[model samples]
Target: MSLPELLLAGFLLLSVLGALLLSLPIAAEQPLNWHQALFTATSAVTVTGLGVVDTSSLSLFGQLVVLGLIQVGGLGFMTCAAMMMVLLGMRLPLYQKRLISESLEHTSFAELAQMVRLVVGFALATELAGTLLLSLVWMPEHGVAAGLWISAFHAISAFNNAGFSLWPDSLAREVADPLVNGVISLLFIVGGLGFVVIAELANWRPGRGLSLHARITLHASGGLILAAMACVLLFEWDNPATLGGLEGLGAKLQAAWFQAVTPRTAGFNTLDIGAMTTPSALLTMLWMFIGAGSGSTASGIKVTTFMVLLLVARAFLKGQARPVAFGRSLSARTVMEAVAVALAGMLLVFGCLLALTITEPGQDFLGLAFESVSAFATVGLSRGVTAELSASGQLVLIATMLLGRVGPISLGYLLATRKTESLRFAEGRVHVG
Candidate 1:
């Protein structure tokens, strides 16, 4: 099958699995329908945090099912399948290799199998370290087993940028807990940093330098995170509803930092997101739209795409013919693709927002728009509008989440695979402004 077909099939299979799991007697009390199961499955698989139902209410088995889906989704279905195939002594076909490469966002097929192994190993190591640190923080309050489970679940969720929380209010209730907030934020930052960059950094030699892709990913990601932190701090510094009323400097700083980092496709939030002012909410919407790196579990158009678009704008302002970044020239195709993706993403968000406005007429426009963008980008931050959305609004969000996770461009590619013939027509020029 083609890459698009493979992805769609994988999504469908995972959705079916979730539905089946939810149908089991132990999992049936909170019985999920096809739409809910499909939405949750896609959200987990895409590492998107938009959920039609509260995860905390699910039974242990159901929660485990969600966790399992997250694990498979974070690694990509094809990668897991490829590994299984290898274990069975089955050689990967060229098409399968290509599908895996695209799924992992790798540029080439060379050493892909080895890369998959490294990816899984590195993911586990990071998740384990995060879990250990989190467990230390949670053990005193919740005791050993409960703390361990919370730690492990959160570690996986944070590292995967999946945002599946055991608590209904998410990490908001633990905002004052420095250890919990700090550890979770650290995990989120590490996870949001693309896997390729991590792998490259791990294998880096003293004299050797980072690859171009690694440098771009790191620099762009760092710049965005720092900017987001500054923006959120400045915007919410005096807002009594958010960071203003806090007496302790440490708590305010921790909350600000956590909020800043989490919006970049990490769904955990220390502050009550719904209480933020219009300006802060707008800033968050922009951050959510930009999101994390390409190959990471984090979604959105990606930091690289945002950077490329900025470079393109800069080139135009400077009267340059080509866009350049990090001492390297960007190709025309790259710029075009970036523009297309951004435009498509914006349109999707706006479209969903419009749908939401009609469905949830009483909702705040700004908050609804922010929620729509968050869902479309798979960033999962909300202005407390998600739980309050009507059934139609929920359906709109579900579609947006799926489109965001699968990607608008990928969906377009899937829908129209046949290339149109370019028959040369009579050349004509029209006068323009």
Candidate 2:
């Protein structure tokens, strides 16, 4: 099987195994039926965080199972397998390295081994730091043992961008708290920025550092976050169920920042998603569609893809022959691929939304569409319609989440499995728009 298909198969297999483990009576407070088990497993594997069942209701064993799935899925199946090989003192096979390359979208094999080791070490160290910092609040609030566990679980979840919260409201109670907001927001941001970016930034020097990918990611991500935060604050400032409910401006701003960060596929919510104004919700969908940077745990069309589209638009509008960004001309192939990925993602979201609308005839149109986008983006910020979706609708979401996590880039490649002739065709003339 091709690497993409194998990767896809790996996710399916892991989801089933996780579901089976979580279905056992000892795993959850109430035994999960196959549907609940599968959905939760798929969500965890995709790191989507859309839970039909409240995670708080899950027994510790079930939660742990989910954590395992998130780690496997977020770090990627092949990466973990490769790391295991390293731990066992075995050399990575060439085939395995190819698999890792496909998964990480890396073209260089020379530094592959060193890069993988660095990624794993970096991930563990980040999660540990997050756990230590988060414990300051939770450990005192809940007792030593439960709080420590909670802290660790959240640290992993946030760093992995998994968004699996043990709390019923998913940290809504801590919306105004600076420590909680800052730590969680930073975790998802770093997690979504891509590992390659992180590794480079760690050893960066003054004035001359950062690769083009890292530079693009940092600037685009920062701009999007700031824009999203402004949109949320401006649109929902007076909405009682969201930022308006807070006592002070500082709390509202913190909550706004948290909301802004979550939409880019983190799935953690400090404010009531459904209660936000329509403008804020629409703004969120835009951000979710244009999710975090490439190679990050978070998914969507990706920030780079969105940036490419914007550059393409700019070129067309200015009647330029080529698209350029930051003094570098973008390749035509890169531009076309970005267009394909974005278009495919939008169409998938649309089709899923249409299906859900048919299945859920009485539901609100905007909410269902929002849920579909959230699932397709793997963003996990629901509008309170998740638990209420029918079995078919939930299945649709499961598929979308898988697509989101697996991504359109790989899926697009999967279609062209056969070798093509080196024949060039003339551009066909078509009617102008």
Candidate 3:
């Protein structure tokens, strides 16, 4: 098996084992069914945040198991394994390094070890900072110990874009607290920005412009976040179900901004997502589907794919022969891969949506579609179907979450097994419409 595939398999296997372990009486008051355990395990390992049951209801032991799975899944199993190998004073086998490279989406092994070290360091630093900031807001409500745990859990969840909240209602209760909202939102933004983007920004040298990849990621992600914020504000400004009922204009704006930013894979909701207007929901779906950047904990087709597609379209519109971005010509192969990834992702969402609609015919189509898209994108913003999905519906979401985590293209690669070429095909002419 290819290194990526092996790594993914190992992760799935570990998740199942973890879930089984969590199902023991010692882990929970009530034993969970195999399906429930598998689903929860997959969701946590994938960082998709779709829970079949209320996470807050789980025993402390069970919750810790889930949190551990999220941490392993967020950084990737292979990545953590590599770190462990390094800590043991063992050199990573060339094969293992290649696997690590694929798992982290790096192009080379030149600095693979350093990159892994950097990823772990930056991730821990950001999460710790986030926890300290959030503790200031959470400590008054909960005691020191509980507050510290809450802060740490949320910090890891936000920085990893895991979206598993300790509160049953997620972060909706904190909408009015500007400090909490601002800190969490900042963590979400930083996490969703992709590690490579942040690393490049951190090591950026003055007078040496950003790399093409970094530039595309930054511009596309920034544009989408701003556009989503504006659209949410415009569509829900007067909607009572969402931000409209807030007492102050500043609170409303803050809530809108937070909602717009978090849905792009962080999955933390500061407002009633189910109460959002159809237009706002639709806009949020778009943002989630175009999610964070490639190689990040966040999923979806990725910001880079959307940016590449846009560049391709722009080139075609201007009658240019080649697609170029930031004065760098994009490889044809990259454009094709982006198109393939997007097509595969959309197909998966559509297929899952169809299955969900059939399984639950009485539910709202828009709501079902939203849930399917959320699962497929690994964005986790749902309109309350998560707790209500039937066995079949849950299975559909499980498949979507797996595809989202492994990537649609990666799954396709596994299935296809081999690429086909045609050099002797006869060309045929057809009439234009």
For each candidate in turn, the TM-score is: 0.92, 0.97, 0.94
lDDT of 2 by residue, 1-433 (tens): 8777777888899989998998999988889998899999999999999989999999999999999998888888888888889888888899888778766666367767777887788889888998989999999999899988998899889988888999889999898789989999898899999877877887788987677778888999999999998899899898988887899889988998899889988999989898988998888999999989777788899898899888989999999988987788888878878888888898999989989988899899989989999998888888989889888888989988887777664754554344575998988999876
Error of 2 at 20 (Å): 0.4
Q: Highest lDDT, which number?
A: 2
The residue ranges of model 1 lying beyond 4 angstroms of the native Cα positions read: 23-25, 28-38, 408-433
- lDDT tens digits, residues 1-433, model 1? 6677668667767867776776566763567766666667667776777777788877888888888888887777888888888778888889888777776664467877777777788888989998999988888889999898889999999988888898877887777788888788888788877767777888999999887778888898788778888888898899897899776888888888888889888888877888887778888888989888877777788888888899889998899899877688898867877888898898998899889888999998888898888888777777777767766887788778767877743744543344665887988999855
Clashes per candidate (backbone, < 3 Å):
0, 0, 0
Q: Which stretches of candidate 2 lie over 4 Å from their true place?
A: 412-421
Q: What is the C-alpha lDDT of each candidate?
A: 0.80, 0.87, 0.83
The global Cα lDDT (0 to 1) of model 2 is 0.87
User: What is the total number of backbone clashes in candidate 3?
Assistant: 0
**Cα lDDT of model 3 by residue, 392-420, tens digit:** 88888888888788864364444334455
Ranked by TM-score, the better of candidates 2 and 3 is 2
